[model samples]
Every structure is written in C-alpha cells, then in structure tokens.
Target: MLEDLDALSLRVQRAVQLAQGLQAERADLMAQIQQLQQRCQALQTQQAAERDEFARMSERLARHDLELQAAQKESAQARGTLEIQLHEQRAHAQSLQHSLQASQADCDRLRTAASGAQQQIELILERLPGAEA
Candidate 1:
C-alpha cells in the first residue's frame, strides 16, 4: 500500500512539473506573439507613410506637368508673334529693295538723256557760223 501511494505521488509531481513547463512555454509564445504584433503595426505605419509620400509626389508631378504645358503654350505664342514680325520685316525690306532698283533705273535713264542732249547742242554749235574745227 505504501508503495502504491509513493508511485501515485511521483506521477502527480511529474504532472505538476509538466504543467509548469507548459505555462512557461505559453508565456514565451505569448511574448513572441506580442512582439510580432508590434512589428506588424510598425510595418503598417511605414506603409501608410510611404503611401502618403507617393501621393504627394504624384501631385507634384501633376503640377509640374501643368506648368510645362503652360510654358509650351506661351512659347508657341511667342514663336507665332515673332514669326509674324519677321514676315512683316521681310516684306518691308523687299519693298525697299524694289524702290531702290526703280530709283536707280530712273537715275541711269536721266543721265543718258542728258548726255545725248549735250552732244546735240555741241553739234549744232559746231555747224553754226564761226565754230572752229
């Protein structure tokens, strides 16, 4: 009977020890679970921050695109105006060139006519009386 009691007591003690070991293991696992949850939360926060940064950069890119489009429009307008001015200047220069050519032709014609008139007058004077050889 005493031997039976001792065996039963030994089994009880081993069960208690096993229960304690299991409790300790549970505590360690719970701690690990808590740390993993915290790490997950941190990761989520970082993701949120990255999302916000991406949105901000996207907005900046959009604004820059708008600015680029406006600049292109302004540059196109400036180019158009300059082209018009250049065309007018070229037209005016061509007109001036034409006028210069006409004036030069008229001057040459007058000089030739004056030279002919002078020769005719000289011949008439020579044929007249007392005109020397």
Candidate 2:
C-alpha cells in the first residue's frame, strides 16, 4: 500500500505540471486573438476612409467634366463669331481699295489737263509782250 501511494503521488505531480502548461498555452492563444481583432478593426477603418475619398473624387470629376463641356461650347461659339467678323472686315477693305483706285485715276486726269492749260497761257503772255513794240 505504501508503494501504491508513492506512484499515485508521482502521477498527481505530473498532472499538475500538465495543467500549468495548458494554462500558459491558453493565455498565449487569447493574446493572439486580441491582436488579430485589433488588426481587423484597423483594416476596416482604412477601407472606410478609402471609400469616402473615392466618392469625393468621383464627384469632383463629374463637376470638371461639366465645366469642360461648357468651355467647349463657348469656344465653338467664339470661333464662329470671329470668322464672321473677319469676313466682314475683308469685304470692307476690298471696297475701300476699289474706291482708292477710282479716286487716283480722276486725280491723274485733272493734273494732265491743268498742265496743258498752263503751257497755253505762257505762250499767250509771250506774244502780248512782243506786241508792245
């Protein structure tokens, strides 16, 4: 009976050691689960922020597209107006050139007639002076 008691005491000691080891393992597993939970929460927060930023950028892009379309329309209108004004200015310049040519021709004819009249008056003046004899 004394030998049986000694063997039972050894078995009890081994069981106590095994229970301590299992407690240590359980604490380590609990710490790991806590760390994993924190990492998952951080990832979720990051994803939410990224989603909000994407929405804002999408709205801004839509606004820019609208502005671009408006600018294009304005540019097209301005280009058409400029073309029309340029055509009118060209026509006006052509008409002015035609008028200038007509006026220059009339001036040339008048100058030729005035030179002939001056020569005839000089000849008459010379004859009158000789008749003074």
lDDT of each: 0.99, 0.93
Q: For every model in order, what is the number of clashing pairs?
A: 0, 0
lDDT of 1 by residue, 62-120 (tens): 99999999999999999999999999999999999999999999999999999999999
State the lDDT of candidate 2 residue by residue for 49-111, as single tens digits.
999999999999999999999999999999999999999999999999999999899889888
Give stretches of model 1 more than 4 Å off: 121-133
Q: What C-alpha lDDT does candidate 2 achieve relative to the native structure?
A: 0.93
Off by over 4 Å in 2: 1-5, 117-133
Among all candidates shown, the one with the greatest TM-score: 1
Residue 93's lDDT in candidate 1: 99
